[model samples]
Target: MTTQFSALFPGLDNPLILKRYPDSSDANLQAWDAADEHLLKHLDESGMLPRRWLVINDSFGALTCALRARHGDTPIDFAADGRTAHLGALENLQSNSLCQQEIHFHDCSQLQSLGNDAAILMKLPKNLNFFADTLSQLSQTLRAGQQVLIGAKAKHINQSLLTLIGKNLGEANASLAWKKTRVIVVTADGKPRPLSKPNRWPVPELGLILENHSNVFAANKLDIGARLMLDNLPVGDFSQVIDLGCGNGVLGLQTARLYPNANVHFVDESAMAVASAMANWALNKLNPDLGKFHWDDCLSHLDAGISADLVLCNPPFHQGEAITDHIAWQMFNDAKRSLKPGGLLHIVGNRHLGYHVKLKRLFGNCKTIASNGKFVILQSVA
Candidate 1:
């Protein structure tokens, strides 16, 4: 990633300084994208600034930082499903020396708390269902005739996309392409749409019923790798456990079921994911005292005194649109730090990911406890 980001958004007299979350080296990525620039460029040209503004799905806070830089006292509100995005945006704001005194940070779930007239600027997200859910929720609060501007790659805009927006929020239209990106203008209808029901499915085999919010990974079904890991979990005496990246808390839920005495910690970066995990734990009637749910970036912010005798992981391979192994690499390193001496890290991954190589390097020893044609379950001792 670029060590420093300098994007010349049109409204700003000077370029804004920004950086991706968990800042480090890797030149393959930048802090902002053309879509982000397109939205800001359109705003500068429109000259229709509202008393307050809400920025959504800002990736690394490029839009929030740019808007904050250009209009410091505008009472900007920022929201994203990713905790990492929130962290990145706050850092970018401080790094640029922008005053956050009037900038309000919130989750989309709290849209009702903000002013109804606040203009919304958003970058289209990768997940359509989550976007639809957000639109439905926003429609409940935003007043009629309000505009929500969404930016996306030109290739991603289409009639069907507009239709989806209309059904959920209001009428929509697209603008001329700039730098292979376009801004979508949506007019709010002020009609309340029914919120989407949480996805609930029975895992009769495991005697578990899983409920997942729209943004949770594998929310609708049991992923194949998790299925394999569930079958081959290392049987041992375990007391304290961590489910790193615990989407929907399935792994941690299973831990609570198998080892009733163990403290099962479910940690994830998505707020919906953490909430879903906690909800699922309650839904399954698991022991309340043994379950802990955390919305955090891996285990980095876990309670200081907490250490795990066992860590179960099904690490994600992608961050937003970029497919990379950096996340899995971080999870392994974090597991090593949080594990007690002689503790174990058990993970399942696609056969092609070569995770065993990294595990061996980090833990000094890695064992292939189970394998199938598509997935491999590996274990490491700290």
Candidate 2:
């Protein structure tokens, strides 16, 4: 796919390069939306040059990359949870041959330690609860009068988001729309805002309580697909197990409990999901070292020589706001490559997704393990 970018200001185009998918595919579907451009333009017009700046949730590195490009070697720090964002940002930076030495990277969980002098530029995340948590964290670090600017599509910048920002941070104001995008500029009042705790729910029969963060999938309850997969776990003893696209790490934790001697790997693309899984794993008293938690896009960064005897997956059919099976396709392919000879790939998916056809084509064999009206559990043995 072609790397396409749009500059909101003169000499300040945001670089966007799609990875792991061809440009000819549905990949070039607006990397930086009008909201991103509007935010950049606002920053340029304001000429508010803070010595240190923090950017959060800059999807595809657009905001961070553009800021660095405009400032020309200014120090900027970026925080994000998704492995894809980190990889994409690095790729975009390299593609543009931009000097990235001054850019600092931090995990989403470490936002509390950031300096108050840093101006926070954030993209309104799709999950409001996560957005609230981010704001709450900012509340702790930001002093009175410090500003946090948030950009989002005009349609998404509703009163609720603005209210949440005000409730968590301080007084907030929205700027006039540009290119159908609006920026909410919020100043810190130095009023302490309590962060939301992870949601806890019990799995009655399993006798396990799962703790999920707001951004985690099926946060308040067990996913029906995951419940079916848990009930139909393969009978064989598996030494090396992988829970691909593990949400809240329910599947991986169950596997760990069932096989205390086995090593279980939890892999997901969401930062909050991985954080929840790690917390739940600790809460359940599972040894942290026994479960390898990866905030990754499927198993892309997983050790290449490491092979799993059993790979359990509830592959996501979408990425961000787009509904597509490309991720599921990639997950299955990665599972096949990561499995040892005669290893098995177990998956639960919506029945209409036609995962059987994809598995059949990839592994030359597919079998139904279980099925409900809306979900199907399938298995493919290498």
Candidate 3:
């Protein structure tokens, strides 16, 4: 079944066509949320568009698409931490018969390239640390007394959040609630603030140290699922191994420790996560040639020539604020497609996720290797 999201863009007569990246089969998930609509609405009502637009953290590029649709000639710059956001934005732009080349695309790491002259439009991220880092980065390049407009659910807007924004960027205030959403208007002070520092934590049992940026999952600590996965690793003389959705490279680092000669690949959608994994690999003094890092959505972009003998996964059940298993579903499917004959897929998940059922359906055999009260280690063979 095919599902398409027509954006709730009030200005456009026909809604802009949009879809989530990797295109979810589940209809419940959407490319854009209310916050995105609220931001676009504010822009429309302002009566005059910004001279130039700088958009941040657009989930699937709804804001970019709407802006492009309304004023095709305006300069629009977009940035986000996830590769999927960029890809989805590009796809949405093309689907709506808009020229993608009109928009300047930047990854989160490319914040320096984004000039401060444009009107800054932002979607309040779930990770305030990442948001603060963004503000700090903007403070460096943006002119003194510049303003940034942020859109978020009304419930998420509060004084503490405003203070955090002001502390990093400038004084902030929220607009009256509209559609259960509020626009946080922030004025950037001329002062530059230091960016968010990476977090470091030690794994005494494995003799590994991990440093991750603000957006990386379990950035500052070892998560319980990974801890459980580490204990139930499968025994195999594997050569090509992949740490699918490797966050901070914990599973891959430990796998390399167990199998010194096997090549380990760390793949993730977040640029920071990939960087963190690569850094952790070097921090552990692993063989430089044996470890590979990729900023990717699942194994969708993995090189076809590289077939994996084993895949270690601690799949994320959510994408952004949506608590859907689409990501885990895609991860499982990609792992099957990337594995060699009879290759093993080892994963850890909460007992309630019913991943065993998914594995059984995909591979025809799902083996429960280990279980605790909260987590289960499941294995499947291709």
Top of the candidates by lDDT? 3
List, residue by residue over 1-382, the lDDT tens digit for candidate 1: 3578688888778888778886746666778999998898888899876888988888888988888788768988898888889889889989988888878877656655554778899889888888888888888887889899999999999898999999998999999999999999999998878877679998998999999887889967889999998898777789999999989888888878889999999999888898889999999998889899887877878887888899999999988987778889999999999999989999999999999999999989999999999999999999
lDDT of 3: 0.89
> Candidate 2 at residue 342, lDDT?
96
Overall lDDT per candidate, in order of appearance? 0.87, 0.83, 0.89
Q: In model 2, which residue pairs have backbone atoms overlapping below 3 Å?
A: 1-23
Q: Which pairs clash in model 3?
A: none
Candidate 2 lDDT tens digits, 251-321: 98998899988888889887878888888898899876788888887888899978999999998777676
List per-candidate RMSD values in Å.
1.3, 2.3, 1.2
43-86: candidate 3 lDDT, tens digit per residue: 77887667788999998988998888888778888988898998
Error of 2 at 253 (Å): 1.4
- What TM-score does each of the candidates earn? 0.97, 0.93, 0.97
